[model samples]
Target: MSKIIDTAHVFFFVVGLEVRQEFAHGALRDTSRARLAVIAGVASVALPALVYVLVVGAAGAEGIEGWGAVVGTDTAFMLGALAIVGPRLSGQLRVFLLTLTVVDDFLAVSIIGIFYSEEIRIVPLLVALACLLALWLLGRSRQWSAAPYVLIVLGLWLATLSSGVHASLAGMIAGLLIPAYPTRRHKVVAARQLFRDFWQSPSASSARAVGRGLSRGVSVNERLHEYLRLPTALLAVPIFALANAGVDLRGGLLVDSLGSPVTWGVVAGLVLGKLLGIGLATLLAVRLGAGRLPEGVGMGSVFGGAALSGIGFTVSLLIIGLAFGTTSDLGRQATLGVFVAMVLACVLGWAIFKVAARRWGEETADLPMTLEPPVDPEVDHIRGPEDAQLTLVEFVDFECPFCAHATGSWEDLHERFGDDLRYVVRHLPHHPHGPIAARAAEAAANQGMFWPWLDFVFTRQHALERDNLVDYAVELGLDVETFTEDLDSAEVAKRVERDAASAADSGAHATPTFFVEGCRLLGSYDARTLTAMLESSRRGTRTQEIPA
Candidate 1:
């Protein structure tokens, strides 16, 4: 009973992510790509239902049909398989696989809501909808903090749980409604606008003396790539794994259910069906000219990815909970299948991928070439002292809200350590407002006002328009004559271009990518994690300095 409840809760959490990623990913503006993405998402839900029907048909009416209709593979099981494959596939192949899996998940969850659900309590669902509406309004108004979102999301989840809907739906609905990172953008805009106003105003003194005291007021996608990559890489997915992976063997009946037909069906579906489905689909797509083959991924690697797809731990557990009710023999059988399939798939996939990758030649993506348009005067020669004790390399987009947050974090670190840290900020302008912002940062750097401008941007990060960048430079007491000229200078453009290429080379698929010393720092780190890494680095430096 407890396990069923736990599994349901985990399912709800993932559903929330699915919803958020679906709606927010492209729904606001409603582009053709966005519409297609949603359609693809909705269509994918059939995989689980088909599996359920097949199993039930095989069992006949005498066998149990379970409670809720859902029957799906586990997410933890799939990811565990991928982990075993290691870096055998090229980055592109890995990304493609990740996305397809997410789409498959989206489909499975939709099946749960549309087919398996027993009741429709409109009031609670409406109430949940209202909460999301309120959050959306706040986010649009540029209230970009994650605090209120966190609190309200909890309430909504509980409400959904009590309202007879799956609680994970709460997560999906709420995540979509909450803004990704708004506060930082609001700050950037406010800061740049303030600086702009100061710049245009007539200066009674030299440009150096003009408005140095100005204060700050405030602050997707190539979806296929991120869609495939983020779900597994993100913390939310991992959290789901930890929560859903536990299966207590203390119960005797569950242990005995391994002999059941339902158990065999689920295990076979994941271990066999996933491999066939994914591998067949991929091969067909390539053969029919729907998609090209990714580099360095051999037939063996493809098979490995397919094999790992059978590790259906998280999603399969959810289906089991919905299908078998609590503490039943069927549920126990399903659980066993999930555990065994995941382990077997992971081990087998890893061996195959490793062997194939070794045979195929280790070629990487041409990241630098694909990142940005070419330029005459390359800025790749801006090298820092190689012998520095500590290096903090950051890839930022001046217009990015997270970049503003990162800028503040960088400043705090610099203030704390002073000369002990050598900070290098690189440009990574992504779509729309990105290039404009990069130009602004580069212009500021030319006049030695880069730090000040960066502080203002972080303080108020949203107003990074092309015009705003120039105006902010003028407001920062930079010589307008020099700054304006430099803004259009080939050198400035080249610098940003070089930064973009370097960011690509460093394995940065998104903005705010950070490297401390040499190792890549994964995900969003708070101050404490950064401090810990820094402290650890210091200890290492001391050890090296000792003549060992």
Candidate 2:
């Protein structure tokens, strides 16, 4: 009974990342890719489960049907496998596997809530729904206190527990309700204004106001995700694993299970089922024009990725607990089978990945995972000390929301590192408004006001029209006539062309591709990483570089 409570705590923390940054990942956007994910994810579960069914039916197994255990793909174990494989794996393989796993985890949680319930309690379920509604309302409110929400979550958790719905489902439910929009423009501007006030006053009262203002800039979802992340990953997950993963394998149970249908089902299903299901689904998707393989993810890489997807532990354990009595002879045999299958899956997947990756001409180990023509100091725009030890480069597109977000990281870097870091910005000009904004910045650069113009663009990216760009020039005290002329000047156009060409060549196809110490930083990063990267550069640390 307490196991459900603790597992919910751990699993919710794992899945709640969706409300903050998880939705922002590239694979989540396309309807085609999302459909592909659903297919692959469902197949990954269903195929394994089919083997369980077939073996149980054929052997006339009694008192247990533990198909649910084989359906889970353990995210933690899969990530551990990736770490063991080193960072030389292609980006496409990582993204596809991650998407598949996340989708399947959600699906499994939904199944648990729907299929694994005890006697239903209508009143408690309604009460839980009401509490969730309150959570939703509070999440949308401009003014909020963590205490109220915490109390409500307690209410919701208790109600969910009483209602016979899996308590862990509450986490996923709450996550689905949390708003995922970016930090809004007006809110950011207001935070800056509040900071401006506090900066001038330098008092405890004003500092409180500034802090509240700054807090308002982040979504409730993002803050909660960060706050709950540490204990969830380090404490809750390990505790749940410790409580469940122990198996008494000192006798004939192991040998008996080797002939048991349950044992063979788990081993064969997770290994062979996942490989064929994920690979064939992907191949079928491409043939049906549903989705294409991500770049650098060949057929062989898909084979490797699917093999890695067989690592199922946490959720599988949860399903086993739900399926049968732990002390029953059948359940004990099932547990032994699970342990044996887990080991086999890991070893088999690793072996398949090595062979498949080798066949694809991918380096198996120790390759410098970085793009060629490494980031150099020679760029279009430069700020900070010319002799700084590290060069921080960004491929900027003013119209891109991510580039606007990148400004926060850049400002934090400049303020903290000062003379130790040289900040370089170059244009990608990929969007409709990008060329105009780039030209405007260049014109401002002629007046030694480039940074100011860029700061304006970062804050007001949606307003980067021709008239607005000109208005920004006036605000910055630049000569309107000269600025207007420079927007179309041959030299400015050539500069934009040169930077665009250089950025394209450097694998900066995406906006805000950052290079720290000549090594590209992929995915999302925060201010702390920026500081650490600068420190690492100063210390001449050999940073891990993967092919971009």
- lDDT string, candidate 1, 113-165, tens digits: 67556676888878777777776776676553445655666667656665666
Query: What's the lDDT for all of these models?
Result: 0.55, 0.71
TM-score of each: 0.57, 0.78
Instruction: Score residue 70 of candidate 2 by CA lDDT.
Output: 77
Which residues of candidate 1, in runs, are more than 4 Å off? 14-70, 76-164, 185-263, 278-343, 352-392, 396-425, 431-496, 509-512, 523-548
Stretches off by above 4 angstroms in model 2 are 24-27, 86-99, 113-118, 140-148, 196-204, 292-302, 361-390, 399-423, 429-432, 439-463, 467-513, 522-539, 542-548
Top TM-score model: 2
In terms of lDDT, model 2 sits at: 0.71
Per-residue C-alpha lDDT of model 2 across residues 260-292, encoded as one tens digit per residue: 887677766777778788889888988899886
What shift in Å separates residue 152 of candidate 2 from its native position after superposition? Answer: 3.0
Model 1 residue 496 CA deviation (Å) reads 4.2
Error of 1 at 40 (Å): 7.9
